[model samples]
Target: MSRGPVDPRLLQLSGPTRRWTAVLAVVTALRTVALVISGIIVGRTSASVITDGTGLADHRAALGVLALLVVARTALAWVEQRYSHRAAAQATEDLRVRALTVLAHRDPRTVDRAEWRTLLTEGTEGLGPYLTGYLPALMSTALATPAVLLVVWFLDAGSAIVAVVTLPLIPVFMWLVGTLTAGRTEKKLMTLGVLSDQLLDLVTGLPTLRALGRLSAPVAEVRRLSDRHRRSTVEVLRIAFLSSMVLEFLATLSIALVAVGIGFRLLDGSMTLAAGLTVLIIIPEVYNPVRQVGTRFHDARDGIVAVDRILTLLTARSDGDTTAHPGTTGEAGGRVSEERDAQDGQGGQGLTVTFDHLSATGRDGPRPRDVTGTARPGQLTVLTGPNGAGKTTALLALLGIATDGVTGTARVTAGPGTGPRLTGTELWDRTSYLPQRPVLDTADATAVGDTSGLSLGQRQRAAVHAELDRSRTTGRDLLLLDEPTAHLDTPNARTMVEALRRRAAEGATVLIASHDPLVTAAADHHIEVRP
Candidate 1:
């Protein structure tokens, strides 16, 4: 599906963010108040001295007072940024956590590795402006612009009238300019996404590409994407420069017109010099808010686009199947409050994972071959298959990660009186899947497994063992491995196999997917898939 327009629904989706936005609203209001008050004081003092033609009776006093207020304004600005950044970081964290939880439960077949990486890594980071900058900007526009105009109206009705009437023209021009490049902006963002995906693939496959003498092509592609990004940025800046010129011209002209009228009024003895000068000075101050809004509008536009993607990811549906068994939450945290009912007892059942008649097709390829498998307690079932023979797909189906293209039902069954069988996340608690290419979040290195002095193989084994330990402690009872030996040498693979079998002997169901005969030979049950 094509990327759709940014919907206000992003702001509406998160209750916590909306509530906190009220806090930002207060901050923005204060910002507006400070801006308007400071502007008025500056305008009034400058006009008073200019119109009165007075020298320094108390110039030092006035300068010192204005300096103090300026210092206060700067302090307020600092505070606003401090709190806004804190709030933005919190909002980003909340959205990222929720998105990741949803992603963990999603069927991997539907959301590929590239998409997940972009959404998780880039999408969350891109949403900074919405909470910290744009939200406050919109708030200030709504709160301060009108009040500033009212002050201008009180200072001089004629200038105020013109300022108020012409102020909306700034937003209108901004929208017009922004619209002219909206398509280009979106196209650029998409290009960046693809570039990001390509760079990630290249980095991950760098060793293989170098071995095969294929590194130059990826390097060329990176250079091309970078050049395109540079051009897009240049185009955006050109538009920005033109838009800024328009705002400046309009603001200057509007203020000048007010000054001319006030000049005529003062010469005609229709108003005091002080009052006419005050009105003249306030003219520019009135349009200042509108001018700021126009500039910040672009940031808000990008923020909306980023937030649209974030909300889409968060709200997408996923099949809610977990492998946790009945008579308990089947959750990893072990908050189950009740013992299994007598009828729920699954004597020696341990766990039974069955994938029945599953099939999937890839991008522009033949329909996926049918795959079937089962894993039972006290037994090690190894699935041996060539590349693309559906071994990984089958494992994912059993793990509930390939639900998108799964044509038939898969179920995890427990013996009688073990409560109803668990599947999905419940099953997840009872199982640990070590993918062929594991993507571990390094943010919590200690939580996944200790990494000190460990080689790649040791790290992988430690992660697997850590999951096993965590499961056993949390009342989980199954483990699944995809290509457990793919990246390891013969010796390390053999060692891991022995460790895996020992876990099986301890009543954990272990299922291994591999192309190596060594892994299959050690298995209590072996299922081979032929292309």
Candidate 2:
């Protein structure tokens, strides 16, 4: 897929990072100013300790000054942390919402199991560390380091010069390690995705594999993928550990050099005892953020890469067609205006679909073909096809999936004014697909305010009834069902069939695709597939 403009995720990052950086910068500057005041107090107190030696009045005053500075710095640091976390959390939430929106618009059939699994598992999982750990580290390096260095320069020019010269080396080394392992890290991630994909495929298809005596084949392939993933992981870990060690050594050596310099100056009386102790305490503070930056660099790199992959997934071409709003005209093609006008004229009656020469396949193999059909307004027409037939595909094609590459002359009767055809947004507005295995997530169910302990059949029936009730307010009515009696045994299937018949009698178009003999026998209208 060709990428468009800048990634939205990257654009979203800019605002939050700016807010967090500003807050952290203020905190760092305040802390540095406090340190300066504290240093002056320390100097004056030291002089009093030497001259007065045992005056209770002098000791008490010094203690009061020192205590105030400590409390102020502590409070500011706490506020900084609280806001930083809030920024991180909000950014992560935005990314998650954008990801879901992208997924919702995607062509369902175009997404393979591996891609879906990667998005669900690795993609979302990367966001937490990226925001909380990596994002703040990046901001701290760019913001806090400079502020700390400025303070150090004011206090001791020599120490400031050393820090300025050495800090760049840490990032340089970090970049080198990152560059060397870039290819390997990507390869490792790819292998891990493949490993997860293989394992999942095996798990979902286990029953079929056992039935067909092909379990060993998939099991062997899964082992191979797992071993490859394990080897790649080991290589990545080895490089990461070595890089961390090198970075640690360099940063420690840099701080040690500053400490050595201050000690030498203190011995020669070039620096006062108060200044020496302050420099000793402040040197580590200057380098501490930089040290943290190095540690979190790996996480940051991985997260950015993961984000890039997510953007690619999100922006991939969808099977859905472009929508034309009422009374709007521009670039949709010839006869588009007429179609919109037709839909407008027919307020009660919405999109009408006619299928010709439709054929589809499951994951296993190609299904039967030549499914000709039409769905009229205010009429329920149930679709029936044999096992391994293209019934589901025919319905999906009507809804604009499995047929994005084709253009057709299929007419959509939108009220009295006939339109060009139904595709994309037009098809979507008139359609709602219920798959054979309607996924019932506990979370999704709660989200829509449907929280009854209902079985699959009961849940679906209630859901369909609720939709029907809502549609009754408007004059448009239609419902599509795939294997409505899939989970029901013989007796229950009969009851559901009678219920569907009643819905059809109430003037709602209910299309059902089922392989059960009971469903085929009970359907008011049937389209059979012969192999």
Best by lDDT: 1
TM-score of every model? 0.82, 0.76
Candidate 1: list runs displaced more than 4 Å.
1-10, 13-20, 34-72, 112-126, 129-133, 213-219, 299-302, 317-343, 361-368, 416-419, 439-444, 447-456, 528-531
Q: How far is 502's C-alpha from truth in model 2 (Å)?
A: 2.9
- Against the reference, the lDDT scores of all candidates come to 0.65, 0.61
Choose the strongest candidate by TM-score: 1
> For residues 89-204, could you state the per-residue lDDT of candidate 2 as single tens digits?
66556655766555544335555656545644664555556556665565556666676677677777888888888878888887788777677767766787788877777788
